[model samples]
Target: MAELLAPASCPLCLGGDNRFYHQDKVRCYWHCAHCALVFADPGSHLAADAELAIYRQHENNPQDSRYRAFLNKLAAPLSQRLGTTGLTGLDFGCGPGPTLSLMLQEAGQQMAVFDPYFANEPEVLQQQYDFICCTEAIEHFYQPAKEWALWLTLLKAGGWLGLMTKLAPTQDEFARWHYKNDPTHVCFFSRETFLFLAERDGFTVEFIGNDVILLHKKALS
Candidate 1:
């Protein structure tokens, strides 16, 4: 039998250990005692190249109407909050084809794109931004702790961070969840998780959909 690793702690809080989560032969999710995020065991995951290949199969086109509409659900509201000033934004994990950055650019926000598998430009990571969006991307992070810290540091004071990912419903449903079936998706977040993350990261969180969340830095003024 595979010996279980030490009790997992909430990656967001690092204070509370997971005690209420479950697991199986293929994967296990643990409820974060501090932040409430139920994530997969890092030891059990796919390789980077293999994961990228899975993502590459996605037909992501900048001009896809339905895709644009789905993104607008988050973009429209975030855009409204920004007012008329053209702010710079970063689209983290833009994937093989970046559509959200295009949409934001069309909305008058100057956008920069970055993707580990697609647009892996080193310079894009050097500049800070007024805002950042990570649609359907956070779930793939192998280093959630490091990546999140870097993301927070990259945002200018009072900037917005938008994220979209399907929230986990129940542990039972998680067993059959098609979203988890995707080899690239490993990290999972719940509303409690987002709230915990926001508070810990010094931002405020708003839920837009089962899969959409907006986190804003505390107002400086």
Candidate 2:
């Protein structure tokens, strides 16, 4: 049993004493009482090359109408939240094709992008922005707390951090969840987890839909 080394900390909240939740032949999933984030054991994470290879197989493209329509789930709502045009934004984890940046640009915002594997624009990350959107990427985080901290720094005061991911299923449904079948996915977030984050980290969060989350950073006092 992998839980033999079970006294694991919640990667997102740094909460201690996470207990065993479930296990498949592949990996062990642990439940965090403090933040409600269910995550896989770090020992189960794939190597960098293996993860990158999987992502490279994706065919997402900026010109694909279906892909653009899909991204509108996050883009349209974020544009509405920004409530105006000409704002600067960053597409924090844009995968290879980079469609969201174009979508937001059409909505009248200037957009930049940074991805550790695909875009890798570290200089862009150094600049603050009015908003940042990370779609379907948070699930792959190995060090979620560090990633969250970096996003906070990249966002200007009162800025929005939009995200899209398949929120974790109820405990009963987790075993059969297709989302968990993706080997690259490590961190699983439930609505309660985001709520805990908003209260602890000083952000106001809104659940846009099943998967879209809009979190606003508190302006400095």
Candidate 3:
């Protein structure tokens, strides 16, 4: 058996470096003592340039009606739930071109965009938002403990946080899953894992689809 290692601190909580009790061929996942987020090590990730090239292959176009319709699966419901909060939002990891922020803007919501590769605006991280969107981005988190808590801080109380990423399946299938093969994808989350996090925090969560989850602060308990 591979020896489990202790993280310097839980990636999400910063409470303390938690121990990683799980591992596989390519990665080790650490469970945060404070938050239940299991994350891969940052050192295990692909280089920034390589990660950028991978993102460049994505086709996220606001003009693409099908894609818009696909995004609406998350956008429409979240908008309906949030109503007119007048809360500005940050789209974490908005990729090379930010279509999700565009969709939110089209819905008459204000949003700031940020991505390590595409829109690396560290300044945006300073200001908080009414809500935050991390679509298809969480799986790429090499440091979930830190990034997620910061994302939580960015949202105002009672604000919504939306995410879209494929849930990790059982280990039997994960070994052969293509989603796990992406060099840029380091972290994997299951619906149960997300629900656990939300429940631990004060947020309430609604799964819009197998790939989308909408979290409202009100539900955080």
What lDDT does the true structure give each of the candidates? 0.81, 0.91, 0.77
Candidate 2 lDDT over residue span 1-221, tens digit each: 42257645789988896988888889888999999999998999999999999999999988899999889999988888899999999997899999999889988999998899999968998889999999999999998999999987889999999999999999889999999989999999999999999998899999977899999999989
Please give the RMSD of candidate 3 to the true structure.
3.4
Tell me each candidate's TM-score. 0.90, 0.96, 0.81
Q: List candidate 2 segments past 4 Å from native.
A: 1-3
lDDT of 3 by residue, 80-167 (tens): 8878855698889888768889989877888899988889879999987888988888888776767878877788788889999987
Could you tell me how far off, in angstroms, the CA of residue 105 lies in candidate 2 after the best superposition?
A: 1.0
Give the per-residue lDDT of model 1 (tens digit) for 46-164. Answer: 88888877887999888889988888887888888777658999999988889999998988889999887889897988988999999998888865787788887889889999888
Displacement of residue 114 (Cα, Å) in model 1 is 1.0
lDDT of 2: 0.91
Evaluate model 3: give its TM-score.
Answer: 0.81
lDDT, residue 97, candidate 1: 85
By TM-score, the best candidate is: 2
Q: What root-mean-square deviation over C-alphas does model 1 reach? A: 2.0
Better of 2 and 3 by TM-score: 2
Off by over 4 Å in 3: 1-10, 13-43, 219-221
